[model samples]
Target: MRVQKIWGADIYRDGGSYGFCFDSDDGQWYEFFLKTRAFEPVSPESHQPPIIYRNGCNSGEVVLRLSWEEAQAFVAPLRYENRRFMELIDIVMTSGGTARRH
Candidate 1:
């Protein structure tokens, strides 16, 4: 998925880095991290979104904040449906959310 679609969403900042939270359909939250330097240039410019590149490095990698089981349990449903949960998790994980700047 393109990062621009959710550019206006909440961005978490920690020290010199900034991260955007993405809620996956599978009930997981993924944080896409970018350096302060990288974000500073594009954050102030409205004409175009930031340019980010993931070159098999940890900096631009997406990290999971919650697992499907953890997230499902957190909501605490009145009744448990293992079968339905499994089916939905499989589908959701297959087409997970992504963030990329073009």
Candidate 2:
């Protein structure tokens, strides 16, 4: 895996997907997810039910020998969740307020 710098994290990519190793406030290198270079989320609510695929902070880590399959698996869910959440939010915003159906 080749290492690169992304969002201040040590990123690695082997052809199909990208991986990263970054430090947290605890100062440990956890498994960082290979997020899409496409969209960047602005609100915390933006990263919901489907994936928003943020730029800096990802879902998980990018360990050694991180393959594309593994990366996609990690990334796919996030986008799905984020997008779903945003859709819900859009519905609420259009409704003009937040209220439980119950």
Residue 83 local lDDT, model 2: 34
Q: Point out where model 1 deviates above 4 Å.
A: 1-15, 37-102
Please state the error at residue 55 of candidate 1 in Å.
Answer: 21
lDDT of 2 at 60: 32
TM-score of each: 0.24, 0.22
How many collisions per candidate?
0, 17
lDDT of 1 by residue, 6-71 (tens): 222222243233333344454444443333333335443211112222321134543333443443
Residue-by-residue lDDT tens digits, candidate 2, 1-102: 222222232222432122233333444444343332224455332211212222234543223332434434433333222332333333223321221221
Best prediction by TM-score: 1
